[model samples]
Target: MTTLPRSYWCHRDFDGPGRGRLELQSMTTPYPGRAVTWMRESVRDALTGLDRPTFGIAWAWLGNHQASGAAIRELRQGRPYTFTLPAPDGHWTWSAHPVSVLPVIETCANAPSSRQQLVPAHANGDPP
Candidate 1:
C-alpha cells in the first residue's frame, strides 16, 4: 500500500487551448502504485505548475472501502479566501484549501511552490 506524506512529480497534458489533465506520479522507484489522476478538464486551462515537473506533497487516508488525498489548491488570478494550516513553530501559517475535499478536486490551476510565486509566500509553499 502507498503511504501518506510522500512526494510526487506533477505533470500536465493539454487536451486543447483551455483544457487539460493533471497527474501526480509517485516518486518511488519501479512505480509501486497507480498514478493519481488529480483532474481532467475539457473546458478549462491546465493547472499551474504542471507545464514542467513540479514537486508536490501527497497525503491520503485509506479506510473501509474509500480513499482521499490532498495537495495545493488550484491557481487563481484573483485573490481567494483561504484557510490556515497551523505550523509547529508557533507561527501562524496559511494554505489554500482545496475547492472540493469530498473527493479532492479544484476548478483552477495549481500554482508552483511559494518560492516560485510572485505574491507573498505561504508557509507551505502555497501561493497567496
Candidate 2:
C-alpha cells in the first residue's frame, strides 16, 4: 500500500478553558506534479480562511499518522525549515512563517478538563 504525507495541528477553544486537541490532515499524490498542485491548493485554502498572513507548520511523524514533536520544537525556536514529500519523479517542499506557534495539548479527545472554567473575551469585548 502507498503511504500519504500527513500534517497535524493543535487546536483549542479560545472561548473556554480546556486542553488543546490534535487535528490531522493528509495529502497523497501519485506524482511530483500532482504533489505540487495539491500542496498549493491546500495552502491557499488554509490561508484564505485565516484573517492574517501567518500559517502553521506540521510534519509527518509516523507511518501516515501523528505529528513530529521534535520538528514542532525546532520550528518554535525560529529555525528555518522545509518539509519534503517524495514523488515518482522528484519531490515537493513546503515552508511557512507563522506569527506564533500554538502549543499542543496532550488529550485523547476534544473535551474541556473543567466545566466551571470560562475564559474572558478580548479587552474590546470582541469575540476571539
Candidate 3:
C-alpha cells in the first residue's frame, strides 16, 4: 500500500452523453515511474465495473502535473462534481469532499445513446 502524496490530484469529466474521461496526475516533483504505473493500473481496476456498454465509453489517462484550473472548474460543474485518488491497497483515498463519484458513473450508465435518440416521434411530434 503505497502512500499517495499530498500533491496527488484527480479529474473526472462526463460528456452529458454516455462518455466519460478520468485523468490522474501529481504535483509533487521526482514522481516515481513505478508509482505512476501503479496508479494507472489502480484506476483501471477501479473502473472495471463500468466496462458494460451501458456505462458508455470510459477512458482513463495519466497526466504529468496539476490539471489546469479551467479543467478543474469545468469538472466541478459536471455530474462528477468530485473525484477521488485511491491508493493501490484500496485502504485509503483522497478527495476534497466526502462524496463518491458514483453519481456520475451511474448517470453515464443510464444515459441514452445517440442511436436511441434517433427513434421517430409520434404523430404529436413527441417521443413515443
Candidate 4:
C-alpha cells in the first residue's frame, strides 16, 4: 500500500433546517486547519490512479480563511477527529479556497452581507 501524507485532509459540513425545502449545500474540508476533502468521484475523474485517496484534503488554516464568519461542523465515520483553526485578529472563521488548488472543485469565501455572501474561489482564487 502507498503511504500517504501523515496528516491527511479532514472534512467539515454546514447544514441547517432548510426553511424552504430539503436542500443540502455540502462543502467538506479538512480540519486542524484550513484543508480540503477530495471525494471518490473527484479523485477518479481527476487523479485517476490516486482514486482511493484517503489522504483526505489539502487546505490552509483558520487564519488563512476569509472574513466571512461562516459556520461549520466537523464530522467523521470513526471517532471524531477534533481540532481547531486558530482565528487571526479581526479575521472571520476559517473559510476555504476550493477551485484555487485544483480544477472543478470550488470553495466558499466571504462576501458582503447584503450582497451574495457566498464567494466561490476559482481554480486559484481567480474569477469565474
The best candidate by TM-score is 2
**Sorted by TM-score, highest first, which candidate order results?**
2, 3, 4, 1
- List TM-scores for all candidates, in order: 0.15, 0.26, 0.22, 0.18
Residues 15-108, candidate 4: write the lDDT tens digits. 3333244232334343423332232222223223222322222122223334112222222222233233222211111223322122333433
lDDT of each: 0.26, 0.38, 0.36, 0.30
Residue pairs in candidate 3 whose N, alpha carbon or C atoms collide under 3 angstroms: none
Q: State the weakest 10-residue window (summed lDDT) of model 2.
A: 10-19
Q: After superposition, how far is residue 127 of candidate 2 from its true place, in Å?
A: 72
**Mind giving the per-residue lDDT tens digits that candidate 3 earns over 1-128?**
55433222332333332333334433221223333344444546556554343223223233423432433443344322133443222222322211222222456558766764656777547866
After superposition, candidate 3 runs with Cα above 4 Å error: 1-31, 51-58, 62-128
Give the C-alpha miss distance for residue 49 in model 1, angstroms. 8.9
Best model number under lDDT: 2
Q: Residue 57 of model 1: what lDDT?
A: 17
Winner on TM-score (3 vs 4) = 3
Worst 10 residues of 1 by lDDT: 55-64
